[model samples]
Target: MTRSVALLAVLAVALLTALSSIFIVDERQKALVLQFGRVVDVKEDPGLAFKLPLIQEVVYYDDRILSRDLDPIEVTPLDDRRLVVDAFARYRIADVNQFRQATGAAGDQSIAVAGRRLDSILRSQTREILGSVSSNDILSSDRAALMLRIRNGAIRDAEALGLEVIDVRLKRTDLPRENLDATFARMRAEREREATDERARGQEAAQRIRAQADRTVVELTSDARRDAEIIRGEADANRNAIFAEAYGADAEFFQFYRSLAAYRASLLEGNSTMVISPDSEFFNYLKSDLGTQ
Candidate 1:
């Protein structure tokens, strides 16, 4: 009975020792082998790993790429204008050994170190890039180019820290609320002033065109009146000249005929006042007629 109990106790201890020696490393995990408080090996492959019971320890680390969304950071442009810039980045561990050397996996020291490095790199890069450009450029199509520069800069600076920057992108860019309102108001006023100036120019041009048209009308009207007056004067002169020519050709007959017309017109009047001799040339036709009657 004593031998059986000792055998059972030995088996239990062996089982516990075997359990302690066996450690599991999943495909998503990278583990470091620590022996006597010092890391002896790094295991990135997925499988079962062996460690001495109560002598070696294993530390697990995440090997996947991580995303960091930086909050909106305020920066001043070259023109001394303030802007809020929101950015994000994707990074992964390139050198697990160096990562572990710099920051242990316990207590999130690795992530904290990465976060600080990323923040410092991002802040310095963003300030440098934004300070060299105008606010309009930062907000406009140049943002693509600026993002490329930022990513390149991060990749260059963060590689020594066992970090590979996959991409850096700007999510949002904005001005302060007060500045936005002031800028919009100024732009509105400038556009309205330009419109007013254009309208004034258009009106002035229209007035000039109208004035020129009125002058042309006045000139045409005056020319027509002058031409009509000249034509009328010519017609009157022609009529007088024709009559004079006919009268000059037969002066004695014209005079005798005119005197006979005058006697007929004067003798038929309602008021009779004859103060002429009977032998006068005015009564020649009247007297002959009277004799014949």
Candidate 2:
């Protein structure tokens, strides 16, 4: 009976110790067991785990992707342009041993403190990189290259803290509100001046074209008039020539007929003629025998 009672006590104690050794590993967590204040083992797998009861302690940490948003920082571009940058970073603990050694069992304290230090470090690095680049370069789509360089630099600096930065992204970049208004004013003035100059040049070109067209119209009208005058003069000369030829073929008949036409045109209707002697030279043709016939 005494032997059985001692064996039962031992089994009860063992059961109690076994119950105390029970631990859990979640899908996103990794744990480290410390024996006598020294890291004895690390549990990286999920599900139920056991450790030396009342002698070992467990430290749990997240292994999933973690992100932190940094504060706003000022960066100066190569063109002397000032910009405000707001960014965030993604990271995951890659080396558990290094993480533990660097953090010194501070656990979550490292992340909270890192958040502050990283803000200052990133701000400084951002200003350095931005100061080396032009404003246009920073504003361009290729600024991703600059971002990659900064992220790599951050990763190198963060290696001492056992933090692995997966990527860094710039969320917003903008000029200060005080400078924005001034910039817009200057841009508006420049655009207005350009528009005015363009309009003036267009008007000048149109005037030149219109003047040239008017000169051409005048030249065409003058040329047509000269040609028409020449043609009319030619027709008049032909008619005169025909009359002269016809008259030259019979001079005496032409003279007599012309004088009679002139007398008929000068005499008035129903008037008695009271001229000089009828034997005048004007009446010589009338006195001739041909005139009598």
Could you say which candidate leads in lDDT?
1
- lDDT of residue 52 for candidate 2: 91
**Candidate 1 runs further than 4 Å off:** 1-20, 35-37, 100-113, 133-149, 152-161, 227-293
Task: List runs of model 2 lying over 4 Å from the truth.
Answer: 1-16, 34-41, 96-110, 235-293
lDDT of 1 by residue, 1-293 (tens): 99999999999999999999989988877888889768888888899988888989988877778898887898899888999899999988777777776665553677887778788898889888888889988989657889888889888888777788898999999988888899899999999999999999999999999999999999999999999999999999998797688679986566666776787787785887888776766655456654222
Q: After superposition, how far is residue 250 of candidate 1 from its true place, in Å?
A: 17
Assess the local accuracy of residue 229 in candidate 2 as a C-alpha lDDT between 0 and 100. Answer: 96
TM-score of each: 0.66, 0.69
Task: Estimate candidate 1's alpha-carbon lDDT, on a 0 to 1 scale.
Answer: 0.84
State the lDDT of candidate 2 residue by residue for 1-293, as single tens digits: 99999999999999999988999989898888888878888888899999999989888888898888888887888787888888888888777667778767546886676666666656767777778989888877778988888788888877877778888888888887777788899999999999999999999999999999999999999999999999999999997787677689876777677768866776768975756786666666667867422
Highest TM-score: give the candidate number. Answer: 2
Backbone clash numbers for all candidates listed:
0, 0
Q: Which residue pairs come into collision in candidate 2?
A: none
